[model samples]
Target: MFNYLKELSFTRGAWLLLTTSCVALEATALYFQHGMGLNPCVMCIYERLALLAILVAGMIGFLAPRFILTRWIALLLGSYGAVKGLTLAIKHTDYQLNPAPWNQCSPFVEFPETLPLNVWFPSIFEASGNCGKIVWQFWGLSMPQWLIAIFAVYTVLFACLVLSQFKRSSGMRERNLFS
Candidate 1:
């Protein structure tokens, strides 16, 4: 069962689909912020940054799905984003669980000032709310909780994708050497 899933996940079309989904996820987040009037906190903004990284990874994976190096790059980027996201999600989850004094927490993170995205699209990338406000929930799981789960799964999948691609390249190399 796991093997089947691993094989399916490593396919070229699957890689493209995986990366496209990251973009869609980010779009949905923007919708929640803009369309739903839900403000995101600093942790949420950081999560969006991680998601943006994943989105870039997916776009690259989509453009060159069959290339081994592309797969490795995608896996690295995806894993990086997922791991970073997981940490932020965990922090958000803690903040939600244990209400902290706003004075102790920074409302918005300070960027390097060179990052124009936060300035140009403040509505999307900027943090507008304090952490610990559970404005959204589904099946009793808050947004950050869901993010943790999603990022954890993505990390595992990225690892598997890397392993699968490495095996494929090595196998091809062996076949070429003998032939």
Candidate 2:
């Protein structure tokens, strides 16, 4: 199992698969949330943004074989996912504030309520949505918990892949110098 994870981290196709799975999962969650009457909380949207970043990075990595750039982008995305997961976990577990900060409450793209430009940034990061509620649970874990697990795994995998690529590039450089 450990060896397989290492391999997946170094392969672009694997990265793409990881990203695609994340996108699909988010879509499924969204479908369940909107179609099934489960409104999302602020933490959920943060997770979505993190997943979006990874999805975009994976698409670019797949399309481009330039490992250095692709790996860097993936690392950035993975870092974002890690932070998002940590934030979600904290908000869901420790802080049980109902109706997250208004900005965190609404979708970033959809601003039902207008705020002054100076206050907009805080709204963007503050926790204010319904997604934080533990409406859906399995084995005592909530939706955000599941999301955090997935994103955390992805982040670790992405980091491993970046390291693997760096090692491979270093090896190639050494070989070229000796030749």
Candidate 3:
């Protein structure tokens, strides 16, 4: 059942999955921001950056050989990125569930001069709208809740990958020693 973990370790498909997922996430975010006229908050922007980092690391990892140390490094970094995103998602979900006394309730969102993501990519990274506004909901859950669910899945997958690699590599070493 889990044999694919060892087999796929040498293939690019594994990293491709992460890369593809991140791209889809970014695309959906862009659609919401540009087409639906819903803007993201500061924390949401940070989440997007984390997702982008995962995407980039996944791409680089896919290009490396499976046994190479670089792939492990990339995987670790990607896992960290996913963890960062999940943390933000949890915070956002909490804020949505319980409205806090914060400046995020403003009618408009403004990016600090230090963070020029809006200026660099207005279409994707702009923060022109408030994050406190519960504008959209699907299946009775808000967007941040959905983001949390997505990140949870990624975290589990990464954990499984890590475990599978460790077990399989140790087994391989034992077989080599016996032979």
lDDT of each: 0.76, 0.59, 0.73
Q: Estimate each model's TM-score.
A: 0.83, 0.66, 0.81
User: Model 3 has how many clashing residue pairs?
Assistant: 0
Error of 3 at 131 (Å): 2.3
Please give, for residues 69-166, the per-residue lDDT of candidate 2 as tens digits. Answer: 55566667666666666666556544343444542333333434664322465433343455435677788877766766776677676666555654
Give a tens-digit lDDT track for model 1, residues 1-179.
44544455446677667767887888889899989989889888889899878878877666655455665677689889888988988888989988857533477677886876678887787787878788999999999999999888888777766566444332232212123
Clashing pairs in model 2, backbone N/Cα/C closer than 3 A: 9-161, 40-131, 41-129, 41-130, 41-131, 42-129, 100-127, 100-128, 101-127, 101-128
In candidate 1, stretches whose alpha carbon ends up further than 4 angstroms from where it belongs are 1-11, 102-105, 168-179
Q: lDDT score of model 3?
A: 0.73
Decreasing lDDT order of the candidates: 1, 3, 2
Question: What is candidate 1's TM-score against the reference?
Answer: 0.83
Query: In candidate 3, what are the lDDT values of residues 8-117, reduced to their tens digit?
Result: 65578878887898999989987887788787776677778878888887888787735457667777877888798899888877777777786344443356789776
In angstroms, how far off is 78's CA in candidate 1? 1.0
What lDDT, from 0 to 1, does candidate 2 have? 0.59
